[model samples]
Target: MSIEEPMRKTEQEIMPARASQITKPLGYDIYPYYSLGDNKIFNGYSSLCDFIIEQKTVVIDGYVGVYWNKLITALKEDLIDRGYALNLIESKNYLKSQAQLNEMIAPFLGTEGSVWGTKTTLTLADYFNMPALTEIEKSTSADINIITGCGASLSDWKAALIYVDLPKNEIQHRMSAGSICNLGLDLQKEQTEMYKCFYFVDWVVLNNHKKALINDIDIFVDAQWEDSINWAYGKDIRKGLEKMSSSVFRARPWFAPGAWGGQWMKEHMPQLDRNEVNYAWSFELIAPENGIVFESSSFLLEVSFDALMFAQNKNVLGVHAAKFGDEFPIRFDFLDTFDGGNLSIQCHPSLKYIQREFGENITQDETYYILDCKDDAKVYLGFQDNINPTEFRDTLEKSNLYNEEIDIEKYVQVHQAKKHDLFLIPNGTVHSAGAENLVLEISATPYIFTFKMYDWVRLDLNGKPRPINIDHAFKNLDFNRKGATVKQELIIKPSILFEDNDFICYHLPTHKEHFYDVHRLEFEAEVEVETNNVCHVLMLVEGAAITVESADGAIMTFPFAETFVIPAAAGSYKMINKGSERAKVIKAFLK
Candidate 1:
């Protein structure tokens, strides 16, 4: 098939009759927020200034991508109008020069041609001139001494600290629009370079800084909006996090369009923008890129997911806390290729390679759970029986360089895909989901290390040739996983683990390389489950809706296609089907 040719409509293109029964709005909440109870969430510059004027000394620190100039200008105007003298100390003045920062981070950023980079070991403090900050801390003379910027807390001033947080998705949006630059840098680069900096250097430093400051913050601000802001007391946010740690919660999901995007999400998800060509990916719960939202009456505030982990890693992760720390070990996302092109033929880095090359603690071990697919849908996986490494590499390289077609089936195995089937893809295995499939990608948290070997001679959405990592793919591809071995080891078969009159639990075994296991609980009425001291990540795959009642009797309704979490501290819970049909929920937990 030519890359530019339109895809033929398949049975999967027709929405299922059951899909009409899903009358509920998009199960994925774009603004999912937790209640702040009686605590008030302040809004607007006037309210912010009203609180700030009362404090003697204040430090307004924020994440990268926040509009520091706009925030400072609004605060100054509001505070001055209220007759308060302000001594503003901008933290950017104390930052190391851009040249110095670039030199320091260059080693972590691989090269101009590659997208991969090593995680940075540098801290926010390392970007500032500590002596200058110390001198400024001693010279605070105005009535309200305020220090503000990305690392304003580094001033060491005994002040009421307010952290302004922007969600990761919003940061990426701002980066794409060329509205923001990396921390300590004044100029914005191309979107890819900026994203590389964020993934490897900027986010790493700021996340560590945020973790260190979590305990001391007095207020938390949501700076996602341009004209308004929502903020709550830090203690109140902490209390909300504590409540969530011991109960059930869902991270707000965001969707994006891609070159090989599909129409599944655009058609089924009513709230999505249909004007886009297609929806390619939904970030269901990729911890590093997702955020938890909190609400107080009509107002909403959001904080990065790591804030919850920093505050209560033990309660959220239970026994696994010691090993994983604040890092959420598992990730859930949606890859919709229904009526779309095939995903790039790719492989992920092995455990040792990921750790050594990228400084990630875990490899991108993955599994594709076929949520929905057409009758003719397929998945490219493993290798052919007589695969030649040299020939395969040469063909892929020549195809990329000459826009020539290579018979992918000659080098890779293709398997028929069906609904509810799970395919294990441990690192080092070559894999790709073919067209006409809505794949639920469950994997380890490290998601950005894909090494693409072939892309079917297609250009990206930007009209540019996508990066092909034939060399990296060759190093990581496991040639031994060929033909019969691929079917024997990678295609998982489910077995009934437990059964009763109302419910049955089926175990879908994962690869040994995966530290997590999967269970599908199908129930007609209600099913009781135990956390067993390990957190559970779940998605309602089969039914329209189900109610999850935690041990404390707190209940939350999750519609079909919604992803949620049950913290380990929740102990036991019950899943009650709220729809006419039986409910099938996928549960992933630490092995």
Candidate 2:
């Protein structure tokens, strides 16, 4: 079968079903582990046999985290059956030696120790010998030249390029399970390089496949080694996205360890492998590190969250789509410090500063909604009335350089955090969550712009001093949010906005700078929620469980600590409490 011929046939086989057939709530068993059945084209080895017979060369550029030998062997065996000779090219053969990589990254390393700056930029060409690969492609005599590496750049030799996409969670899972080797690279540097690979996958590979070579690619598979595999042609795969956008969306949550990690998530999220040291964060809705799940009859498909934003930006963001375009404008993540230490004393940049410095559309304006906290837990916010700016700067510098434990209380104010306290942290306000707190950080989507000023003079989990950005902090910090002003404005007091027979809505006031609003929905039976052309982000903050039903009759349940999104296109939905006790949900949406 020719590639162009199979394209039309596959489209007919996977055409979008009617709205009713596709909008049903997926069974609990249909995600993260399930596999869609094999076909001749999608997620199947037979899909590429024709390519091996037709093309003189093929390249399989994939992440180093994958089992490349197994995948390549499968392709080679299939090619042999089709009476074609195959020559294998290993990317590792061209990698710079350990000493060379270390020297190349030396300038980016911090002077204090082995820590690396966030701006350490490395490209795929920097790590792999692409010139050598091009030469091999030109000279190879085999019927098919299978070039396998992290295909971070587009090349003509990559005729019929197929990206074997894997979620970041699964990549870490393979790493932690000892299924893949780390190649003796610094963990931070490895992560940095992997992120660059991801950028290439999304930008260079996916964009070209979905746009330029929409009908030319062989297969794009969502792979989890042997457990699951899903494949689709570029065009049919895009049609699948349209069906998914209007439905209830959930991203695969990824857990990672941190210096100030806690056991809260390890105890709560049983789906995670708890053998690890600690789980500090659940990247619940951070699109960069998250993935959206799509289910078919036999298998579940997973793509990066940004794929949905790219395909259906207006459907997901609704009226706010113009402002954010393909970027999802809100973030929801857990900051677990329970039985751990405080977060770094930090503040996010203002909009102007973030745009000029970090090239971000919006700043990380944030709010800390206390989900769970120990009795003695408190939040350090703003500055004390008598804090001297010069003294504070000098103290932080000394702490960073000389490891001095300057009295934090002398400069920063601490406020008691309760079960439902909402602390508004607009950009430029210094803040940190104290020990023994489970903080649900609801804020604008721009997360990585945090400028840390202090870190309690302790080393990071990697046994190195974390980078401190005192100059950035001082430039963005708003000292006027101090003394009584912090208490009056930053510490939000919730007020009842509506009440009925079975439900009560309490408005949690946001800062003037906040483009979104947070509301606590306390209910015994049910509550009618309108999308109002703005998407709503929901968290089961104080509940055993609840079910969200769309107007079209599609429904999905949410348990405690679970994060779910309702696209503005879904219009209206109902939140029905299923537990015996009353349920409380923290809902954030555009104001």
Q: Which candidate comes out best when scored by lDDT? A: 1
Error of 1 at 520 (Å): 0.4
Candidate 2 weakest ten by summed lDDT: 3-12
TM-score of each: 0.95, 0.79
Off by over 4 Å in 2: 1-70, 87-153, 156-161, 170-218, 224-229, 233-236
Query: What tens digits encode model 1's per-residue C-alpha lDDT throughout 1-591?
Result: 122222221111211112122234646444455676744677788887877878868899989988887788889988888787778889999988889988988998899857889999999988988899767853445778899998999888888999999988878776665677888898878888889999999999999999999999998998877656888899999999999998999998888778788999887887665677888999999999999987775577888999999999999999999999999999999999999999999999999998998999999999999999999999999999999998888888899889998889999999999999999999999999999999999999988899999999898888998888988887888999998999999999999998999789999999999999999999999988999899999999998889999997778888888899999999989999999999999999999
Judged by lDDT against the true structure, how good is candidate 1? 0.87
In the order shown, the candidates' Cα RMSDs to the true structure are: 6.2, 8.1
lDDT of 2 at 94: 72
| Candidate 1 segments exceeding 4 Å error | 1-28, 138-141
Output the number of the TM-score-best candidate: 1
Cα distance off (Å), candidate 1, residue 314: 0.5
- Give me candidate 1's TM-score against the actual structure: 0.95
